[model samples]
Structures are given as structure tokens and as C-alpha cells.
Target: MKVLVTVKRVPDPETTIRVKSDGSGIETDNIKYVINPFDEIALEEALRIKEKLGAGEVVLVSIGDSVVTEQLRTGLAMGADRAILVGCDQDLDSLAVARILAKIVEDEGPQLVLMGKQAIDDDANQAGQMLAALLGWPQATFASEVVLSDDQQAVKVTREVDGGLETIGFALPGIITSDLRLNEPRYASLPGIMKARKKEIKEVAAADLDADMSPRLTINSLEPPTQKEAGKKVETVEELIGLLHDEAKVI
Candidate 1:
């Protein structure tokens, strides 16, 4: 029943994002950061699973700059027994990120790993899959519901698909990517916050993980989409039809 929950720190959803002046990336200077909303759901799911089992530990893992500790602390306050900071400060693709986590998995053997279906910033749902593939473990993506066997040897996961939900069962040592419908996340209480400060957090360097940073993808640049002006409204249906046939070219 041991669980490892992965989290990420991203700019607060309420914050307005400005593209960098140099066109490299977004300007994050002095911007407030918060736990990724999707990862919050994953943490909630892992907490629930641990609480249900009432016997196993829940470890929260995050790979980012030193600022990511805030996000990890939030998870610790929510009920994670411990935290692991991979401490990869710079930007990394999903593959490298997955490699770092997989190294942590090798060091601390956990039966289950849970993560967000995708990061809000990149919306790239590749980390969990990459980790699972690298570890050669079964993976269930976009999971909404999870049903574990009596002995906790296997898991039946329900995931949302194009039209309906699909259920798949896999053995232990599996990875699952969570969706928004998983569960509601809770804010840490004062007592919980104090307890989090005392919780054990093991910091490891990128070298310790032996993770390669060679990126398979590159970000050319980011720019806003083209803006369109409002079109004049035609009062009569005939006029609208004429406009559609001419300027609009719908006809």
C-alpha cells in the first residue's frame, strides 16, 4: 500500500502570465507560485489511498528549483509521510523529469506512484508515461477511479477516454496519472502545518539521480495567437446571406 505522489510548482493560476522580453519563455520574476492543480488532485488521491489502507506510508516527490519546497510542504501538510526533493532547478523536458523520478523510485521502492495527468504550464502529459516505460511497469493514465485488490497486489483503474470511461486492471508496482475528478484537496490546518515542518525531507542532487538532461524537444518561441476584429452585424437575413456569400464566403 506504499504510495509515491509526484507534485510540481507552477505560477498561480490567477496570475497573469507575460511572455519574456527576450522571447525565451515566460517572465516569472516575483510571481507567486503554487502547487499544480492537477498534482493536487494526485496528492489527494494518494492521501486517500494511504488513509484507506491505514498502514502504509505516502511519500511526496518533487523535482524543481529550491522554490519547489513550498509545494512539497503543502503535500506533507496534507498527509504525506515524507518528501523527496530532486532539486533540478532549470527547465527540463518530461523525459528528463521522468528519469529523475525513476531514480528516486529505484532508491525507495514504492508499490504505487501517482501523478497528474498533465502539467498546467506545458500541458504535456508525458512524464508519468515515460517513468512507467523506463521502469517497465504498468501504467494507467487519466485515472478517475482506482480500485485496489484485497491484498493490494493488483489495481483496477477507471480512466476517462474520448467518449466514455475505460477500466483497466494492472498488478502492483504500477503508475497512475490522475484527472480532476479524483478527489477534493484540503488546505493544511495550523496543527498540520506545524507537523509538516517536523516531517523528514530528503534532498538529493541531479547527479545522485544520475539523470541525463539531454532534451528531445526544444521551445522555439511563444507568442499570442492572432487577434481578430469584430465583424459588422447585418440587420436583415437577406443582408446576412449576401455577406456570407461574398465577404464571409460561407456560401
Candidate 2:
């Protein structure tokens, strides 16, 4: 089994986010970058699957500039066999990203492609589905658990849906978008980090994939959310009801 795990480099969730002065994008200066947490879960799942099989490869792929190599090396340290950096520094929407991934998928011919359900930065949650569509493969999104069938021809995926869990069986050579509960990602040890440093990271230009890199959406501007006003205290339930009915317009 050959598994491809896609990862994303994102601003550290714990770090404070500030908008650029020109309303272009977030202020990246002095901000820390890490692998998307959900994507880390995906990489962990792929590593576990490879370990279970005892004879397979787990390849990590990501799209970004050279800084993204940091996250890719982290994934490698976590046990990915190799890493590929799709050198795309320009802003790419979900569709363009999907197209690039689809091209890589076609070239690599992996039995499974594992990635996060959504990138936290954009929260688009569209790439895996679009890649599946382009590949004409079955998809299991928001997967909390994935188990390979006894025959090794299909995967039983447990998904986290709106109401509850749903299980679906998908044949090999499909795509899976992992959810938060999929698995706890393992940390890279010192020895693992050293080994990862020795591993090769191949870089390919986004245009080399031959996918259309055209931007479908353009961001006009970005602004921070308005600050909330302080709440007022009400002396009586009737007063609260009156406020809700009139000022708040709930009623």
C-alpha cells in the first residue's frame, strides 16, 4: 500500500492574528508557523496504516513556499517515508489546490490519499472532494477511523457527521479527509528528527504539475471582526424580555 498524506503550513493557532495594514492578508511577520493540526492527524493516521501493513510507504506532500519545508520535515520525522513540496508561493484557492493535488495523484498513483477535512486558515474544506471527483474515486470525508479490509482491497471508514457517526466502505485508490478525532498525532523524537534530516525532500513547481493555477476567487480586503460591546444588566425577567423583543429584536 502506498499512502499519500497532504499537509498544510498554517499560522500557529495559539498565536495572535493581526491583519495587514493594507487589508491584504494576515500579518505574517514574527508569526510562528506549524502544520495544520487536522493535517497532523491525517499524517499520523497514514503512518499508523503504514506501520500496520509493515510493508508500505507513507509520503507527505504540501503546497507552499520554502517555509513549508519545515512542516514537511516535521511530517517526515513523524515517520513519513518521503516528502514532496509543491512549490506554490502564490495564493491558491481550494479548486486550484485540488487540481494540483489531482495531478500529483495521477503521477504518483497512490492507493490512498489522506489529508485534513479543512485547512484552518481558509476553512474551505473542498480540496479532498474535488480531488476525488477529478480522480473518479470514492471519498470518505471527516473520517474519525479508517480500517483496511481483511482482503486489503477496501477501507472501512467511520465518519463524523452532523448527527452522529456514519461508516462507509470504499475501495482502494480513494481519498479520505480526516477529522479531528481521527487520532492523536505523535511527536517526533530526537533520533527521528535526525533521521528526517537525512531524508530527501523533492521540490516541484506548481506549474510543473500542468494544472491550471488560475485564481477563481480574489480577496478584496480583510479586516478584523468588530469588537463586542459590554452587556447591560437587567433587573427583571420582564425587562430582559422587553429588551429581547425590542432592542435585540429576537421576538
Candidate 3:
């Protein structure tokens, strides 16, 4: 079972985001960066699967610039065998990003592709699905649990939907996007960190993929949202009702 995990370098969730002056995208300068939290769980799941089988390789793949190596190293530290970096400068939509990953899948020829449900920055939950479509393979999104089935040719996946859980049996050579409940990501020990530097990180350029990297949509401009006016304090239920009926026009 050769597992390929797709991870991302996302801005730290705690960082204050500011849209770029030209409105093309968000300003990334000086912001702290980290591996996408959900991708960490996906990596964890991949490691667990490989550990259980006691065989196969866990390959981490990401599409980004030089800084993304640190994020990929996080997966290597957690037990991935190796990594592939598709160096894409600027930003890419989920569609273009998935295309690059699909190329890596062809190069690596992994039996499974694991990734986070969505990256925290864009919240575009489309990469895995797009990759599956691009590869013409089956996909299971929002998978909370995954168990190998009877013959190791299939996987029993339990996914979380609105209000409940759903199960599906998918064949191997598929993609799965993991949710938060999957597992807690392990921290890289000092030794693991040192060893990660030695692990192989194969980098490739976007132009080499023979794909155009153009945005289909253009952003006009971006500005801070208008501040909301403070409402009058209501001391009693009657006052609240009055305010709702008149000032807020709720009633």
C-alpha cells in the first residue's frame, strides 16, 4: 500500500489577515506559517495505515515554493518515507493545484492519496475531489475513519455529514480527505527534526507540467468590512422587545 499524502503550507490561523493592495490575493509577507492542521491529520492517518500494514511507503506531496519544504518536512518527521514538492509561485486555485498534484501521482504511482478536507486559508474543499476527477479515480471526502477491508483491495470509510455519519466502501487507488476527528498529529522530536533534513525532497517546477497557471476569475478590489454600530443596552425584556420591533425592525 503506497500512500501519497497531499499536504499544504497555510498561514497560521492566529495571524491577522490582510488583503493585498491590488486585490489579487491576501498579503503573505511576515505572516507565520504552518502545515495545514487538517493535512496533519491526513498524514497521521497515512502513517497509521502504513504502520498497520507493516509495509509500503508514505510519500508526502505538496505544491508551493521553497518555504513549503518546511511544511513537507513536518510530514517526513511524522514518518513519511519521502516527499515531492511542486514548486508553484504566487497562489493557485484548487483546480490548478490539483492538476499539479495529479502529475505527482503519476510520477509516484501511489495506491492511495490522502489530503485534508480543506486548507485553512482559502477553505476551498475542492482539491481532492478535483484530483480524483483528474485521475478518473474514486474519492471519499470528509472521511472521519478509514479501515482496510477484507482483501486490502478496498477501504471502508466513515464520513461525517450534516447531522450524521455515512459509510462507503471504496476501492484502492482512491483519494480521501480527512476531517479533524481522525487523529491528533504528533510533534516532531529533536531527532526526527534533524533526520527530516536528510530526507529526500524532490522539487519540480510548474512550467514543467505543461499546464497553464492562470486564474479563471479576477478580483476587483478588497476592503475591510464596515464596522457595526453598537446597539442600545436593554435592561428589561420589554425594552428588548421594543428595540427589536422598532430600531432593528425584527418584529
Candidate 4:
């Protein structure tokens, strides 16, 4: 079984984000980058599946420029067999990203594809579903648990929905978007880090994929949220109620 996992480069959750002065985007300078947390969980799940089967490959794929190689190498150190970096410097929206990934999927023909339900930076949870639609494959999103059949022909995924948990089954050659609860990612061991230095990271220019690179959506501007006003102290519950009704307008 070959599992293809999509990895995304995102700002570290702990890092403080500063919007660019021109309102174009966030300032990238002096910011730390890491694999999207949800994508890391997906990669971990792929590694665990390979380890359990004792015979399989876990491949990582990301779309970005040379800078993304750092995150790819980190994933390699986490036990992925190899990586493919689709080189593109321009920002791509979810649909363009999905088209590129679909092209790669066609070329690789992996039995399963795993990726995060959403990227932290944009929070646009559309890629996985769009990719699935492009490939006409079954998809399970927000997956908290995934089980593969002995024959490796089918899979069962338990996912989180608005109401509660939902379990669904699908055959191989499908897509699963992992959620936060899927699994905790492991750190790269010293030996693994050393080995990653030798692992192959193949780069393919995005233009060669023949997928439409045009972005359907555009970011006009980015700005930080306005700071909230400080709270006021009240003498009693009556005062609080009055304030809520008159000032906050909740009552």
C-alpha cells in the first residue's frame, strides 16, 4: 500500500503574526514555519499505517518553492519514504492547489491520500473535497480514526461532524482529511534526522504538471482584528443587566 500525504508549510502556532503594513499579507520575516499541525497528524497516521502493515510507502507532497524543503525534510525525518515538492512561488488558492494535487495523484496512483482538513493560515477547508471531486474518489473529512482492511482494499473512517461522530466505509484509492484527534505527531529521532539528509526530495516545477495554476480567489487585503474595549466594573447584578441592555445590546 502506498499512501500519499499532503503537507503544508504554515507559521508556527506559537509565533506572533504581524500583518504587513500595506495590508497585502502577513509579514514573513522573523516568523517560524512548521508543517500544518493537522497535516502533521495526517503524516503520523500514514506512518503508523505503514509500520503496522510492515510493507508500504508513505510519501509526502507539498506545493511551494525551495523554502518549503525544510518542512519536507522534517516530514522525511518522521519516517516518510520520500517527498515531492511542486515548485511554485506564487500564492495559490484552494482550487488551484487541488488541481495540482489531482495531477500528482494521477501520476502517483497511490492507494490512499491523507491531508489536513484545513490549513491554519487560511482555514479554507476545501482542498481535500475538491481533490476528491476531481478524481471521482470517495472522501472522508475530519477523520479522527482510520482503519484499513486486511486485504488493503477497503478502509473505514470515523469522523467528527457538527452533531457528533460518524463512521463511514470506503474502498481503496480514496482521500481522508485528518482532524486534530487523529493522533499525536512524534518528534524526529537523532538517527531519523541523520537519515533524512539522504532521503530523496524530488522537485517538479508546477508549470509542468499542466494543471491550471490560475487562482480563482484573490486576497485583497489582510488586517489584524480590532482590539476589544476593556470591560467596566459594576457594583451589582442590576448594574450588569442594565449595562448589557443599554451598552452591549444583548438583553
Candidate 5:
């Protein structure tokens, strides 16, 4: 079983983000980057699956420029067999990313594809579903648990929905997007890190894939959210009720 996992390099969650002065994008100077947390979970799940089967490949794929290799190396250190980096310097929207991934999926021909439900930077949770749509494959998103059949022909995924947990089954050649509770990602050991340095990281230019690199969506501007007003203390219950009814307009 060959499992293809998508990895994304994102700003470290602890890093402070500031919008560019011209509103084009976030300030990247001196920012720390790491693998997207959800994608890390997805990679971990893929590694676990391969380890359990004892005879499978876990391939990591990422779409970005040379800097993304850092995150790819991290995935390789976590036990991925190899990695593919789709080289693109321009910022791509969700649809463009999906198109690129679809092209890679066709080429790799993996039995399963795993990725994060959403990217932290954009919070756009559209890629996995769009990829499934383009390939006409079954998709299970927000997966918290995944189980593969002994024959490796089918898979069962437990996902989180608005109401509660939902379990679904599908055959191989499908996609699953990892959620927070999927699994705990392991830290790369020293030996693993050293081995990862030797692992192959194949870079393919985005233009070579023949996927449309043109972004369908455009970002007009980005701005920091407005600061909230400080709360006011009410001395009496009647005053609080008046504030809610007339000023706050809740009533």
C-alpha cells in the first residue's frame, strides 16, 4: 500500500502575524515556520499505517518553493519513504492547490491520500474535497480515526461532524483529511533526523505538471482584525437589562 500524504509549511502557531503594509500578505521576515499541525497528524497516521502493515510506502508531498523542503525533511524524518515538492513561488489559492495536487495524484497513483482538513494560514478547507471531485474519488474529511482492511482494498473512517461523530467506509484510492483528534504526532528522533538528510526529496516545477497554476481567487487586501472594545461594569441588574435591551440590542 502506498500512502501519499500532503504536507504544508506554515508559520509556527506561536509566531505573531502582521499584515503587510500594502495588504498583499502577511509579514514573513523573521517568522518561524513548521509543518501544519493537522498535516503533521495526517503524516503521522500514514506512518503508523505503514509501520503496522510492515510493507508499504509513506510518501510526502508539498506544494511550495525551496523553503518548503524544511517541512518535507521533517516529514521524511518522521518515517516517510521519500517526498515530492511541487515548486511554485507564487501564492496559490485553494483551487489552484487542488489542481496541482490532482496532477500529482494521477502521477503517483497512491492507494490513499491524506492531508489536513484546512491550512492554518487561510483556514480554507477546500483542497481535499476539490481533489476528490477532480479525481472522482471517495473522500472522508475531518477524519479522527482511519482503519484499513486486511486486504488493503477498503478503509473505514470515523469523522467529526456538526452533530457528532460519523463513521463511513470506502474502498481504496480515496482521500482522507485529518482533524485534530486523529493522532498525536511524534517528534523526530536524532537518528531519524540524520537519516532524513539522506532521504530523496524530488522537486518538480509546478509548470511541468500541466496543471493550471493561475489562481482563480484573488486576495484584495488583508488587515488585522479590529480590536474589541473593553467591557463596562454595570452596578445594578436593571442597568444591565437596560444596556442589553437598548444599547446592545439583544432584547
Candidate 6:
């Protein structure tokens, strides 16, 4: 069983984000970067699956500039057999990213492709489905649990739906997107970090993938959200009622 896990480099979730000077995008300067939380969960799930099989490889793949290699290394330290960096300097839409991943999937021919349900930065939950569509493979998104068949020919997945959990099954060579409750990600130990430094990470340019890397959407401008005014205290119930009826108007 060969598994491909997709990871992403994103701004630290704890930091405050500010729009760029020209309102084009967020200011990444002086900001810390880390692997997407959901992607980390995906990696953890893939590593667990590989360990259970005891005879398979878990490869980590990321799409971005050289900076993304840091996140890939982190995945390697977490027990990924190898890593691949899709060198794409420009910002790509979810569809374009899926196309690139599909190209790699064609080349690698993994039995399963696991990734996050959405990237926190954009919150676009479309890559996994788009990749499945591009590759003509079955897909199960927002997977809370994944169990391989006894024969290892298929996988049963429990998904987190709107009202309740939905369990579904898919044959091999499919894609599964990890949800938040899938698993807890483990921290890379010192030995693992040292080993990851020695592991080979192959770099492949986006152009080499031969996929259309054009953007289908554009952001005209990014504006900061309006700040709310401070609230005033009402000393009496009658005063509050008067304010609600005259100014607040909720009543």
C-alpha cells in the first residue's frame, strides 16, 4: 500500500493577520509559518496507516515555493517515507492545485491520496474533490475515521456530515480528506528530526507537471473588517427598554 499525503504551509493560526498596504493580500512579512493544522492531521493518519500495514511507504507532497520544503521536512520527521516539493512560485487556485496534484498522482500511482478537507488560509474545501474528479477516482471528504479492508483492496470511511456521521466505502486508488477529529498529530522527536534532515526530498517544478496553472478567479481588493463600537451601560430596566425602542430598535 503506497500512500500519498498532501501537506500545506500556512501562516500560524495564532497570529493576527493584516491586509497588505495595497489591499492585494495579507502581509506575510514577519509572520510565522507552520503546517496547516488539518494537513498535520492528515499526515498523522497516513503515518498510522503505514505503521499498521508495516510494509508500505507514506510519501509527503506539497505545492509551493522553496519555503514550503520546511513543512515537508516536518512531515518527514513525523514518519513520512519521502517527500516531494512541487515548485510553484505563484499563488494557485484550488482547481489549479488539484490539477497539479492529479498530475503527480498519475506519475506516482499511489493506492491512496490523503489530504486536509480545507486549507485554513483560504477555507476552500475543494482540492480533494477536484483531484478525484481530475483523476477519475473515488473520493471521501471530511473523514473522521478510515479503515482498510481485510483484503486491503478497499477502505471504509466515516465522514462528519452536517447532522450526523455517514459511513462510506471506496476501492483502492481513491482520495480521502481528513477532518479535525480524525486524529491527534504527534510531535517530531529529536531523532526523527535528524533522520528527516538526511532524507531526500525531490523537487519538481509546476511547469514540468504540464498542468494548466492559471488562476480562474481574482481578488479585486481586500478590506479590513469594520470594528464594532463599544457598548453603553443602562442603569435601569426602563432606560434599557427606552434605548431598545428608540435607538437599538431590536424590540
lDDT winner: 4
Which candidate has the highest TM-score of all? 4
Candidate 4 lDDT (Cα, 0 to 1): 0.96
Quote each prediction's TM-score. 0.91, 0.92, 0.89, 0.95, 0.93, 0.92
Candidate 6 residues lying further than 4 Å off, grouped into runs, are 231-251
Per-candidate Cα lDDT values, in order, are: 0.89, 0.93, 0.88, 0.96, 0.95, 0.93
Name the 10 consecutive residues with the lowest summed lDDT in model 1. 222-231
Model 6 Cα lDDT, one tens digit per residue, 1-251:
89999999999999999998799999988899999999999999998998898889999899999999899899999889899999988989999999999999999999999999999988999999999999999999999999999888999999999999999998898999999999999999989999999998999999988999899988899888888999999899999999999998999
Estimate, for each residue in 1-251, the C-alpha lDDT of model 4 and write its tens digit: 99999999999999999999999999998999999999999999999999999999999999999999999999999999999999999989999999999999999999999999999999999999999999999999999999999899999999999999999999989999999999999999999999999999999999999999887798999989998999899999999999999998999
Query: How accurate locally is residue 18 in candidate 3, as Cα lDDT from 0 to 100?
Result: 88
Per residue, candidate 2 scores C-alpha lDDT tens digits across 1-251 of 89999999999999999999899999988899899999999999998988888889999989988989999999999888999899988999999999999988988899999989998988999999999998899999999999999777899999999999999997898999999999999999888899999998999999888999899999999998888999999999999999999999989
Model 5, span 147-180: residue lDDT tens: 9998999999999999999999999899999999
lDDT of 6 at 22: 97
lDDT of 3 by residue, 1-251 (tens): 89999889989999998888777768878899998999999999999988888898999988888988988888888889899898888678888888888888898898899999999977889989999999999998999999987567989889999999999987898999999997888888888888888999998898899765677645577776667998677689998999889888989
Residue 199 in model 6: shift from native, Å?
Answer: 0.8
Better of 3 and 6 by lDDT: 6
lDDT of 2: 0.93
Q: Is 1 or 2 the stronger prediction by TM-score? A: 2
lDDT of 3 at 121: 78
Kindly indicate the candidate among 1 and 6 with the higher TM-score. 6
Q: lDDT: which is higher, 3 or 5? A: 5
Estimate, for each residue in 165-246, the C-alpha lDDT of model 1 and write its tens digit. Answer: 9999999999999998877888888888889999998888886667887788999998755668887977899999999999
